[model samples]
Target: MEENKREVQVTLVESILIMIGMFAILGALIIGAEMPPQIPILLVFTLLMFYGRLRHVTWDQIFAGIIEGIKPGIIPIMIFLMIGLLVSSWLRSGTIATIMVIGFKILSAQFFLLTVFLICCLIGITVGSSFTTISTMGIAFMGIGHILGFSAAITAGAIVSGAFFGNNMSPLSDTSNLTTGLTKVNLYDHLKNMAITAIPSALITLGLFFILGRTSSTADLTQTQQISQQLQRSFNVSIWALLPILVLLLLAWRQVPAIPTLLVGSLTALVVILVSSPGYSVSQIGTLLMNGNAAKTGSHTVDRLMSGGGINNMLGSVSLIIVALALGGLLIQYGVVHTLITSIKQYVNTPGKLILLNMLSGIGVNFLVGEQYLSIILPGTTFMSSYDRLGLPRKYLTRTLASGGADVNALVPWGVSGVFIAGTLGVNPLAYVPLAFYAYIDPIITILFGFTLVTWRYRRSGKRPATSTATTSVGLKDRDQPVN
Candidate 1:
């Protein structure tokens, strides 16, 4: 028994060391080090250090442990592939292009920045993807920002804020779904409850962007026109082409399986392409689906913005998710994550306190471990019981964890989401962190709502249960008592 305890302790220490080494390497990679070399270097060091302390553990065992750690993420991985398919098909059908042209027509230099924020908010609510919104429409706005003489920093901020704000509120988002599932909350009710806080945060952000947009005067009509023309000429943009996107959104709202939802959207897009863009052959369409859209506009900005899903586009991101989750799995299998969560779980007591702790822990794990999904799951499972004891609705807890966990991933430079977004956009994560107003505001707003009793439902005075389960697993079941 003593030996087993000692083994667990040693493994935890080794895992900590490995995490530290990984962050160091991640730092190097962010600063422009080659990933290929950095990955092997860190792996070797991690293996050697882990082996030294837990020498009895075999390499095969460690590898097995890592695979087990990643097993839980398989569902999310499949969802990502579907997301890739969805983006590819949607783009080919002209949904994204139509939105771009429409967005361009309505946004003047005076209102462009605010418009970007508003559009991001709207699309984010519809699709529930901050990353997708940023990668697609956000990229186009960067060009628009450049042309309009707006600061890239500010433009990036608006995009980040708007995109994440909608993601937080969107019922279709994975983070949102996971949160609701973990807490056994009704998804729509959870969203309705969040409106009390989310609406304020968004309004405040929109107001700030509006003021900034009006005060900062920089506009290049010629550049904006060129960008608009570039988009118009590149693909067959029409209202009919937007049907695929609408279909995908409708399917998601119906809570259909994500894979089939994406496949349906892709099929619709292919049909649209075949019927509308007769210049392209079926073989060429196949290539575009596999390789994604590339800009032929001869402008780097336009080219970058036009790029969307092809099966190939998901490779790098998929690879990153696998490694990061594998490492997470290893930490879990070896008991490192168990020890950490067990320790963090001791501090939470009241519902308000639990909400705050979950938010902090989610942010902390991201900062320490440099991963986002684990950041959400760990704190969420660890603090579930605390919410039950305080008679707080599970949705509040779900909203709290997600608002803090998933949205701000790109702010931490060493974190996987942060690194990936930075690499894709060619902008440093730190450079954009300060401007990510919604990222910082989300947790604060969610926490404040919890403490103030706003939009919170709990046990009624006449119906309070004499005894309630006070364990993390309780949130997984229904609580029958009426909420205050």
Candidate 2:
């Protein structure tokens, strides 16, 4: 069976056809028909299964591939559930309300978007998780944006751009650490190299957002004051409400795993609700956790802002992730992705071509697989030897991975990050793509660097680039296996 499997290689034509078919089906169903992404993804998965059968792959092989694909998303799925709980807990504990109230008092309409971008950047860097930032700070900003009369699409765009920028740069981010670990580059060196592109992209993004803020509709001070007063009355808005956010950030800084950090944050929120409010019983808290905050704060704006969160709200995202990952698994199991990568490798003779191809491959994987980790892992692994052969330092490859793989995932409509963000922010996933300047800008800058050799570093003649010993500190056991 192993020998037979080795002999079964998907041709370039077959791979290309499958990819085109996938895009067509997804486009027709998602864009043309305006159906939800899960249905289209499931249809694509079924078609791929049939295609796999035609390629002589066994049913067992296909099922195994799906299971393998889902393995990568298990932690993310767990995080999703915990995030649902955390959001609701924070809502009940007045954390989000306090942030919104405080934001209205200090944040101006002129720099609202700019301030939102910077604040989210700080929170994202501190937490090292885009999802967490999006759920907590992102939610608060959305409420403020609504109260301030900004469009949700534009607000979500700025939030996503800043959150992902920090995610790419944070030392504790899984994708950043994964990119450096897989490519055998020093973490800090990769970060510094990433700045070559990241800085320009971020500055450009900030400028664009500043202009948007300037042109935004004037803030309604009366409405803002009314909402602030209502929020204070409905929830116990105090400094004590911020303990949950502080706890989450401190755990992230300490390098604790994401799951435990979220769990602890949720637990802390429950404690805050009990000690600070003292009106709700333990049973009521459990009910709130399961069914979300049911408090009718009397103000329509406050009610709209605080009504969501709970495991029920997250089930849609979780379902979408499962189907998408299963589809990605079949793509990998059927050799479509491998064929595409191998066919593209022949033309990567120069450093410029290699960098461009690497970036494109990472973006392509995000579109095809809808999983971010594979976007980094596949291209980084495929081109690792090529970079070494070209005498280019591994930092270039890792930086490119962050630019193309990690950052771009949020723009992919069916991607895990995209789905989660859309569900959390209550915006269409595609609506914010055009405004996510940093996500797309970094790749363009990195590609330009590749062609210009502006920031490229070369290994000494007759010597290969040395692997960084610092990789062990990131807890990477071996190059073959990245930490989850």
Where in model 2 is the C-alpha error above 4 Å?
1-8, 455-484
lDDT of 1 at 68: 63
Residue pairs whose backbone atoms clash in candidate 2: none
Judged by whole-model lDDT over C-alpha atoms, candidate 1 comes out at: 0.68
| Candidate 2: tens digits of C-alpha lDDT, residues 15-76 | 99989999999999998999999999999999888878887888778887898788899999
Assess candidate 1 and give its TM-score to the true structure.
0.80
| Candidate 1 lDDT by residue in tens digits, 123-148 | 88877766656755676677567667
RMSD of 2: 4.6
lDDT of 2 at 473: 30
After superposing all C-alphas onto the true structure, candidate 1 shows an RMSD in angstroms of 4.6
C-alpha local distance difference test of each model: 0.68, 0.86
Clashes per model (N, Cα, C within 3 A): 3, 0
- What value does the lDDT take at residue 137 in candidate 1? 68
Task: Give the Å shift of residue 305 in candidate 1.
Answer: 3.7
